[model samples]
Target chain A: MPKLKRTDPDERATDFVESLDRGLRLLQVFGTISGPATLSDLARAADLPRATARRILFTLAHGGFVATDGKLFALTPHVLTLSGSYLRSNQVVTVLQPVLDRIATAAQEISSLALLDGDDVVFVARSSPTRMFSAGLDIGYRLPSFCTSVGRAMLGRLDDAELAARLKAMRREAVTPQTVTDPKKLLAAIIADRAKGYSLVDREAEPHFRSISVPVRRYDGTIVAAINMGAHVDRVPKQELIERFLPLLRDGADDVKNRLL
Target chain B: MPKLKRTDPDERATDFVESLDRGLRLLQVFGTISGPATLSDLARAADLPRATARRILFTLAHGGFVATDGKLFALTPHVLTLSGSYLRSNQVVTVLQPVLDRIATAAQEISSLALLDGDDVVFVARSSPTRMFSAGLDIGYRLPSFCTSVGRAMLGRLDDAELAARLKAMRREAVTPQTVTDPKKLLAAIIADRAKGYSLVDREAEPHFRSISVPVRRYDGTIVAAINMGAHVDRVPKQELIERFLPLLRDGADDVKNRLL
Candidate 1:
């Protein structure tokens, strides 16, 4: 994964609290590994010295966010409070959850809400029907902004200069045979989505998966996020998505805008 | 809320990262407040010096875990990665989510799985049917063990001495009119649940909520978590819960135990 971009030069200055940043980075490293990690494993993955990693681990364990069985360290359920704090305090999820749940039930597919964080679209809220795709696209799942339906929908709201800049900064790749990798073509697709009020992608994010997304606007008429519903290509034909799910998604986005403060 | 217990004397020694602990505690304080907070608000709530809190907030902002509009600071969607990391790494939620979803759909109610964390049970996975109660019982919701059905189900698995100690340590309060506050009665109820292999609570956690829970065990027969289904009291009678939900919850628990490694 790419590192978080440091926009400010004073990140290394005295006011930054370097150990706090290292400790949080270590927490993110746990997600990249499969199971419990030893001190050496964490130090190697986080690119920190063993002594610094050990101190951070000690602090995390003392905070009840990480647990240890003497030899290996793993995150505890207490870590959920950090996410819970964000979900509960943020108004976007609170406003969009029920709206997306209604859309998911009506569409009989997985519905999700995502926001553009840096260059990736990070899913923040989701509502799933009984039947779902095997992609495991739960909350916090992230995908690059140049290819996903939700990403295109959200990027459509950006100004021309910013859109071109993000598109240039992205490590554009053909993740699937159908993914559009050319910068000019990607820009044209996003521009078309801006005119159409929605975006549709076919087999770009995952094979046999098709999704349509609509941008969610706030009370001030500014786009805050994007909402999408998706299904398998065999299950949902491309034409049917534009006919059935597009209106439903647009309605859901409108409801969210009206409800959001 | 009470602070995390520090059992190791070495917490005050050189190896501990005090700023990291303070920064995490500040994150928790955000959950206790309403929306965006000023530096003074966070410093007061976290009980840290203004300068200390300011530096930590800067570090968190640099890490993309927080956002600021110059005057007020709020958590960004990036914070969800912390909880997402825990969920993705923890095997228990991976095994229980599908089982709980099936149970919830079949029962037409809300089903959840929670693990024992200190004196509280933190909800880690949940599935809700089309209709749900007004309470926001999403993942990461926390309730005291002495009153909630899932809490009692898991607490019943603890050794006698430890269970008694936790019960005594709790700040025992009557959250609702129907809550059981007496320590002896709470212990008796939990012990009965142990014998019966399930726990049922009527209007204890909330005024009109009732739930039935079954403990989820691992391959070694040690309880790791608990699963439950709940409904409004008027919608589900006590006898109906035992006859209908109890069997379903037990089957779900058995399925989780079998699947978990």
Candidate 2:
């Protein structure tokens, strides 16, 4: 679980602040752990020296971003403000959240919008009719793109050469038994989705979960993101998903495109 | 507006990482400014030297946390991951979101949960029936505690002496024409809400927006947060809010208590 993308800046860069990078990395490390972590645990998880980790943690604590109880440290709610700035200022999230909410209510399923970040798709806005299937799918949740409906839907918008490069660069893994790990097959699937105007992934990203997605295009018809509706396989058959939700998702995407700049 | 509270740690602390603190402050400054910002604008907003701001921006940019055009910088979606770790690990948000969604759907208004962070209440979870009135009340939105129903409800659970001290320390201002700024009146209102088991704020924090909230207690009877439903004053009168929404909020709060640790 190396969360930092390979695109991370070179440490040798003169202006790169290693301490700030390490501190941010440490914050993400806390997310990987279940609960409060000790100094040793945080240091090991962050792959930093214990003394360095302690200094970073102390700084975080002083800023009210981290909470401590004797030997254990945990993040405080103040950390939410870090993302609040991006989310509030993001036009994609601000404009499309209502569309997703409407789609979720009308379709009685979880609705989400994801943007391609690095080789992964990050959920930027989401709405749910119920709490079901919220795990790992909330706003800010990230997933490998090649194996997810939203990922493929967004990838389908890329030029063939760029898509091929991305697919080759992706570290394809069998997230579930149904996941497509072959590059050629995945590319074909994405191409077909591009032609069909949507992408559907069945039990590929998660067990028993299937999703259908369509790319949301900006005014110039450039794809900006992907919007999707996901459900448990037990509740939604493949045919029902295609026949019922695709039109709704497309309409929602259209609405978003009209509203978004 | 000084977003950092007065409780900010003494910068003279031995382990204080000034660069890290300045980087985090810069991130918040971007949020305050709309869209992309010039380096000078960001430096001015963050009150940092141009050279220092440039270095931090380069580090953030290298980390993919900040995006820069030829002349301007904006936060990238990667910033969301900073909060993602906290939100995903947070029990309060994980446990209360579904409950809030249920309340919102049932009540046909927006429902939210807020926790006291310093003298402000930070919205930790929220659900909306429609996207109406969501401008400044989304999850992670922070508001002064004295004038908000959710804030008052959470403060009501504080011991009288602590509450008095908090009110005395508060930088109360007339946020709206109807906002009660006097410490004594705010304290009395909080006390009355505690006695009645709910807090109602009418056009105090925002014009034409009224909300009713109930304190959520932990298994040990310690107040953990507050849950509320808010609607436009035009849509729901003060009498109807108390008569219809108070019990629903209380029940939601009770459900949260039963489920939370």
Candidate 3:
């Protein structure tokens, strides 16, 4: 019998299957939608032909990642295992959870860790203080990096070319009156924040909310993510925030970096 | 172009791509491990031959779900989108988050929502009171159904045969001295909990931790999940948990069921 040719490095393209890419994209289509989706809805959303979508859905159902009522398809809890694996391997969120807990209570505000993903920042872990309103964010919630404190802090760590490319790529549309949408202004602000070792965005993501963030860095000086404490503007002024909570944010970042080891 | 065969109900076998199946299995292997793993480690853990594992890993890495440092591979935060879509579509956890938050703050304890997955209960959402220790669980942590209050509350809502099969499949060994390991005794306790509209687990998971839980049911009386409040034994005794917190749990459950509509 002939060998599968996987032993040769150049034959990797033959070994790497393309259908798996399509299958994962199918799952992503299901995620972007709001509720249970029909087969045609998924096919259209994923930009795949209906027949291919159906077969992939069948395979997914057989795999336990999905379940359907013979019409509407939704993912099962088993899918969480995929995210669970990521969280477990990353270890930063798990190890720094205690530190985040402390920062929230000590600062009496909501705190979170967010990693830069493309032009968005994804909240990886969060701790909330008891309050009248929520931050309206869950673990996987995303927000444009140019308009958020956590996003800016993470962005401040990138090299000049990367930062310029990402800023050029962003929509740069203002979310609020205070949002910095101009690419040049955003870059100058990021450079300033980097010099100050943190980013403090006031009434940017929301009118009432302000976030103060510090980039979590490895011992080698590479930024891994950002940690922040968010409070209502009326509850805490920007100056008081820097004085009272900045230390906790810095400590949280240090604790997170230590966990990356 | 030749017509794709998905139009025929009998042709699913042709559509189930084997490579996609193996690719998912590889991700599961990463979930099982605690940290970054080598290619051989993943192959052995996933029970796949090294070539298949390498090819699948290549596919996953290209998909941006898996990242490596030339030696060890790990899942990236982007994988959360798979579960994120599930959570977003399910709507139960998102709607009930406020209720869980209110319950946590009102009762001065931690509250979580869990759904039954096979023989285990998986926490889908959680909120914690400002405290020193964590709830020690994240989104997808699983535990045996018979020992924990959330598990037993959901089990209480199940019909006899379903509950019996789940109980029979459980390990049933004591996690703590307080855990009820015998099936008949566990079933009787579940029946008792069902009769009372909630389940109270006293130090079942740990000697110092106690929890009270209630089943979340649809308007049609079909149970969907369980919501629970967990506190330390020294802070809240079992009787006060029943008297003070049981009503809150039921209210939260009712609120959750309304969101199912």
RMSD of each: 4.1, 4.9, 5.7
Query: Which candidate has the top score in DockQ?
Result: 1
Q: Score chain A of each prediction against the true chain A by TM-score and list the results.
A: 0.92, 0.89, 0.88
TM-score of 3: 0.89
Q: Write the per-residue lDDT of candidate 3 for residues B1-261, one digit (tens) a residue.
A: 111122234445777878888888888778778877788999999999998888888778777777666567777767877877877777667787898889878887778888877678888887766653333237788888789998888887668887777787778879898888988889888988888888889888878999989998876677778999877888887888888989888888887675674
lDDT of each: 0.83, 0.81, 0.78
lDDT of 3 by residue, A176-235 (tens): 888878888888889899999999998888888998999988666777788898778887
lDDT of 1 by residue, A1-261 (tens): 111232333444688899999999999999988768788999999999998998999889888898775557888889988987887887888888888778877888778889888778998888766542212226678898888999999998778888888798788878899999888889989998999999999999888998999999887777879999888999889999999999999998888776665
Query: Sorted on TM-score, highest at the top, how do the candidates line up?
Result: 1, 3, 2
- Range of the 10 consecutive residues with the lowest summed lDDT in candidate 1 chain A: A1-10
| Fnat of model 3, as a fraction | 0.43
Native-to-model Cα distance after best TM-score fit, residue B102 in candidate 2, in Å: 5.0
Point to the candidate with the largest lDDT: 1
